[model samples]
Target: MSTIFGIPTPALYGQILIGLINGSFYALLSLGLAVIFGLLRVINFAHGAQYMLGAFVAYLLLNYLGINYWLALIVAPLVVGAVAVVIERTMLSRLYGVDHLYGLLLTFGLALILEGAFRHWFGAAGQPYAAPSQLSGGVNLGFMFLPIYRGWVVVASLVICIGTWLLIEKTQLGAYLRAATENATLVQAFGVNVPLLLTLTYGLGAALAAFAGVLAAPIYQVSPLMGTNLIIVVFAVVVVGGMGSILGAIITGYVLGILEGLTKVFYPEASSIVIFVIMAIVLLVRPAGLFGREE
Candidate 1:
C-alpha cells in the first residue's frame, strides 16, 4: 500500500469524500445563519433544533404517513419554516427594540425546549431513516468508492447554496432585503412591508436549516442530539467565514471540512478541535472574520 505522508492513499481519498459530505452540511447551515443574521441582526440559536425537527419530521412522514423521501424533502422544510414564522411573530418580534442579548437568550431557550421535548418523546438514541431507492448505490472512482447518496448531497448543497446566493445578491427581492437590512425604517417608508419581510426572512433561514437536516437524514442517525452536536462546529465555520457573509460562509465551510478531514488522516487526535483552533486564530488575527467587513 503506497502511503502519502505516512497515510495510505486510499484512506486519504476516503477522508476527503467524507469531508466533502460534511462540508455540504456546514455550508448549508452556516449559509442560513448568515442570511438571517445579515437581515434580522438576530443570532438564531434555535437553528439546530429546527434542523433536528426537519429530520424528525421526515422520519415521521415516512414511517407513519407513508410520505416518501422526495416529498419529505419539500414538506419538512416548509413545516419547520412555518413554525419559525410563528416564533418570530409571537416571540422574536418583540425583542427588536431591546438588547440583542435578549434575542439570543430567547432563541437559546427555544433551542433547549425543542431539544428537551424531542428527547422526552424519542429518547436519546438515534432512529433509522433509509435513503431513497434511487440513491442506494455507489460509484467506484478507481482509488475510492463514492456513495451515490453522499454525492447527491454534495451536488444538492452546491445547487442550493448557489441558488440562494443568486437570490440574495442578484434579484430585485434580494435588493429589497439588503436595503432593509441597512435601513428598515426608510425601506418601510417606501411602502415595503418590512415586518413581513422580516418574518419571511426568518422562515427562509429556518427552511434552509431544515433542508440541510433532510439532506443529512440518511447519512446520520435521526437523533434529538444530532443538531446540538453539530451546531457548535457550524457556528465556528460561520465565525471563521465572517458573520453575515453568505459567500464567506459557503467557502469557509467546504475549506474547513477538507482541513478537518486531512487532519483526521494525519493527526487524528486534533481532528475534532482543528476547526475551533482555526476559529480562535481567525478571531485573533481578524476580529471581523475572514470575509466580514469591519464596523
Candidate 2:
C-alpha cells in the first residue's frame, strides 16, 4: 500500500474525490448567489430553503406520484423556480430601492418559515432517496473506485457553470442583463422591462439552488436541515470568490473544495475551518473579495 505523506494512496484519492464532489455543490450554489446578488442586489437567504424544497419535492414526487428521478430532476426545479417567481413578484419586489439589509432579513424570515413548515410536516428525520438504477454502480479505476452518480454530479455541475458563464458573458440577453444591472432606468427607457428581468433573475437563481439539491438527494439524506448546514459554507465560498463574479465563484468553489480535501488528509482537525480561514485571509487582503471590484 503506497502512501502519500504517510496516508494510504486510496484514502488520499478518496478524500480528493469527495472534495471534488463537495466543490461541485459549492460551485452550483455559489453561482446562483452571485447571479442574484450581482444583479438584484438581494442576498437570498432563502436559497438554502429553496434547495431543501427541491429535494422534498423530488421525494414527494417519487414516493407519492410514482415520478422517477429523471422526471423529478426536470420538474422539481421548475416547480421551485416558479414558486420563487411568485415570491419575488408578491413580496421581494417591494424591497427594491430600500436597504439591502431589509432584503436579507426578509429572505431570512422566509427561510425560517419554510424550514419550520417542512419540519412540522416531515419531522426532523431524513428521508432516503435512492440513486437511479443506471447510476447505482461504481467503476473500479486502478487507483480508486469512482461512483457514477458522483462523477455525473461533477460533470453536470461543470456544464451548468460553464453554460451559465457563457450566457452571462457572451450572449445578447446577458448584455441586456448587465446593462439593466448597471442602469435600470436607462434600460427601462429603452423598453427592456427591468422589473421582469429582476424577477426572472431571482427565479433562475432559486432554480439553480433547487437543481443542486436534486443532485444531492441521493448522496445526503433529504432532510429539512440539509441545505441549512451547507449554506454557511457556501456563503464563505461566495465571500472568497467575490459575490458577483460568476467565473470567480465557479473557480473558487472547486479550489477551496480541493483545499479542504487536502486539509483532511494533512490535518484532520482543521478540515472544517479551512474554508473560513481562507475566507478570512481573503477578506483581510481584499475586502471586496478576490474578484469583486473595490467600492
Candidate 3:
C-alpha cells in the first residue's frame, strides 16, 4: 500500500527492474560497438545482424541438435564469432585505412542481406525460446517479484562487461591491441601480427554481440527482426557514452536504461524518445559525447 512520489511502491520498483534489465542489453551491445570502433576504427553496422545470428544459432541448436541453453550460450558466440572472423579476413581486411564510410556501407549491406535471408527462411514472426529449468521462476523481494532469468541476465552482463573492461585496460594483449590501433606499423615492427590482431578484434566484437543475443533469446522472442528493433537504441547509447570509450559505454548504458524506465513511469509518451533526446543534447553540447574525447 505504500507509494513513492505518488506511484505505488511495487510499480516503481518494477519499472526500475525493467530499466536495469534493458540496460543490461544496451550495455552488452554498446560494449561490442565501442570495442570495434576503438580498436579498429570501423563502424560496424552489421552488429545487429550478428546479434540476430547468435540467437538463431541458439534456437537451431535447441530444436535440431537438442542442445540446451547452457551449451548454446557457449557455442553460439563461437560460431558467430568465427563467422565474423571469416568476414573480416575475406572482405573487411581490404577496406581498412580507408574512409570509415566504406566499412559502414559494407556492414550495412551485410545486415540487409542477413535480415532478408532470415526473414525469407524463418518468416517475420517471432519464435518462443523457453528459459532453462534452472532459471524458470521468480522470487519475491517484498516490494517486487524478480524473475530468476532476468536476475541472471543482469549478473551475467555485468560480469562480462567488467571482464571485458579488465581485459582491454589491464591485460598485455589489450595493450597490444591499443598499440596496434594507435600505430599498426610500430606494433607490427615489434613482431605483432597486426592483421591477425585486427581480425581477432572484429571477431571479439562480434562475439560480444552474439553473447548478448544468447542472453536476450529467452527474454525476447527469437525473431530475425529482433536485432533491428534494438540496434538503434544501442547505437544511441554508444554515441551518448562516447564512441570508442569502453568505460563510457558500460556506464552510460545502465544510466540511460534507468532513465528510460523512469520516463516510462512518469510520462509514458516520452519514454521512447528520451534516450534519443539526450543523445541529441549530448551531440550539440559535446559532440565528442559525455565520455568521448574530442578529436
Per-residue lDDT over 1-295 for candidate 2, one digit per residue giving the tens place of the 0 to 100 score: 9998789999999999999989998999999999999888999999999999999999999999999999999899999999999999999999997999999999999999999999999999999999999999999999999999999999989999999999999998899888988888999999998899999999999999999999999999999998878889999999998875899999999999999998999999999999999999999999899888876
- Candidate 3, residues 13-57, lDDT tens digits: the string is 889888998999899999999989887788898999999999999
Per-residue lDDT tens digits of candidate 1, residues 1-295?
Answer: 8889888898999999888888998999999998999888888889899999999999999999999999999999999999999999999999999988888889999999999999999999999999999999999988888889999999999999999999999999999999999999999999999999999999999999999999999999999999978988998998899875789899999999989998899899999999999999999999889999987
Q: Would you estimate the TM-scores of all the predictions?
A: 0.98, 0.98, 0.98
**What's the lDDT for residue 10 in model 3?**
87
In candidate 3, residue 182 scores what lDDT?
80
* Positional deviation of residue 203's Cα in model 1 after best superposition, in angstroms: 0.2
Please list all clashing residue pairs in model 3, or write none if there are none: none
Predicted model with the maximum lDDT: 1
Clashes (backbone N, CA, C under 3 Å), per candidate, total 0, 0, 0
User: Between the candidate structures 1 and 2, which one is better when assessed by lDDT?
Assistant: 1
Model 2 spans with C-alpha error above 4 angstroms:
none
The Cα local distance difference test for each model comes to: 0.93, 0.92, 0.92
